[model samples]
Target: MTLPSRNIFRYKTETRQSMHSLSPFMSDDVVPGVNHSPVKAPRKVPRSPYKVLDAPALQDDFYLNLVDWSSHNVLAVGLGNCVYLWNACSSKVTKLCDLGVDDCVCSVGWAQRGTHLAVGTNNGKVQ
Candidate 1:
């Protein structure tokens, strides 16, 4: 017969002092130090991908958008079970369609007059 240890509940943290303690939103045209942070314009360097095809097995999968650039220029790549058709004006690399082996092509759209090529599958099958 020995059981008596249960009393630890202390709660008293009152901290509410803000009658505009030196501009804590007290505005009558406030600009004491001026630092709202917004004047950044000097970062332009991104132009080096006219063509760089080499997607072996390609299933990196970032929610799978799997490459697509066509307005008759054509690029559509979805690798794993094949769906490659890069033809930027006859730089040629066509193999389009092979979603076999239990399907793993993922996603590859190219039909805005590129003559239709919408293969997407991880067993979801878009074709």
Candidate 2:
């Protein structure tokens, strides 16, 4: 004997009214005016597929550094006397700062919670 559990269930086609009836959150107050706006073509800018630092703009010994998301959302690298941060998503260099460094950055790392930045330099004795 065939059991009811072996029966195939046909999916019921849902109508706009039926869907609205099933959920009280749906409303029928959609705009009724026809849209006269022109359709726009999809933008064709190239996409960068990387999400992490790819060393695309390191030019010096890599020293002075800070994280300013408005500049480089991913990471801000300080290159000796010149500091730069790149866009985290596009890998584009966004901000640049110059430090009067006669040498490379001796110390650079994220702050305690990674929400802030800290940098150190060496004059001749201490780093």
Best by lDDT: 1
Question: Could you estimate the TM-score for every candidate?
Answer: 0.25, 0.35
Error of 1 at 43 (Å): 38
- Tens-digit lDDT track of model 1 for 43-119: 98878876678887687768998899988887888888888788888888878778778877878887778788788
Model 1, global lDDT = 0.78
Error of 1 at 88 (Å): 9.5
Task: For model 1, name the residue pairs that clash.
Answer: none
Pairs that collide, model 2: 64-78, 72-86
For each candidate, C-alpha RMSD in Å?
14.4, 10.8
Give the distance in Å from residue 42's predicted Cα in candidate 2 to where it truly belongs. Answer: 36
Model 1 residue 8 CA deviation in Å: 99
